[model samples]
Target: MSAAAGAEAWGLAGLASNDPGDIHFDIVLRGYDREQVDERLRFLGDELATAEQALAAARERTAGLEEELASARGELERRVPDPDVGFGNRVEKILRLAEEEAAEIRQRAGTRPRRSSSRPGPRPSSSTPCAMMSSSGCVAPRTCSTSTSTRPGSPTDSRGGSPERRVAWSPRTGED
Candidate 1:
């Protein structure tokens, strides 16, 4: 099935039952990058779960508010007796219609197919040279060293494969 259709069908229950081991990828020398793919899938699953929970909470809150409104209306009707058959009769009719409409709305909301917005993939870190460097100049490797420090010769992140500080070296001049 298409991803949109699958998403529509899969609720929290389906997601809970899904076994990551059941997933199969085309095998080459190393298959797909297992770690990266798994991490992205895990992130997507988490986002889906969060969205589902939010929807459920919103539904519960709405149901509570509807019940409260009905109760308040009932209490108001009981405390104030309708002496006049004209104004009170019209008000009563309107309330009855409103209640019916609310019931219909609730029914439709319950039966309608739910659609969750798809979240975009994880973004590349801005601290990376590939992301920060201007497109007009050199294209650095994505795995290039990254550091949060503002000054030159600052310590790079652990992922850069170097324990030493990253020096700002000019490729042409070979000077730091």
Candidate 2:
């Protein structure tokens, strides 16, 4: 051991090792043994030496922890941008730019003239006949059933109403 630690140990060794742990007392009707209380002095001798050693060890551990905490703080400083130099403002500027782009896109979408819908909308409800389901690839609505439109001649729905609602016009095969 170092000279200072050796000297401190030697000093503690010289003091009486008697402490509360070795002492005993009987539970009497009155109170504790007065002699035992006087002899141990409520954990004085060995406890003092042990407490000193524990305190010294704790101080060393605390010093190491303090050093580690300081090092972590230094590492954090290196990673983070300093608030003084536009850090918050830079983030706000980027968000503002994104918002402006979104607004411009919305305006462009709104300004463009919408084309009229040529796509067929939804079919009539199930109660009404849909022309497409007939065997001739869309017979007239009047002849909605596949069996009813089995008339084997025309390529088009001659009883045409709306073109989309009419029977599909394909080249009539010689067999038909």
Could you estimate the TM-score for every candidate? 0.31, 0.28
lDDT of 1 at 140: 32
Candidate 1: C-alpha lDDT: 0.50
Pick the lDDT winner: 1
The positional error of residue 37 in candidate 2, measured at the CA in angstroms, is: 9.8
For 1-176, candidate 2 gives per-residue lDDT tens digits of 53233324544221234453543465466797564444344346446677899999999999999999999999999998778666788677666655765587569659987332233342332222333222334322332211112122223334332323223333333453
Candidate 1 per-residue lDDT, tens place, 1-176, comes to 43334433543222222467644444457776564355446646776887899999999999999999999999999988767866888677666655765587569759987432122222232332322133354333333332223223223322332222233322332331
Please give the RMSD to the true structure for each candidate, in Å: 45.3, 18.8
In model 1, the clashing pairs are: none
- Among these predictions, the greatest TM-score belongs to 1
Give model 1 RMSD, 1 decimal: 45.3
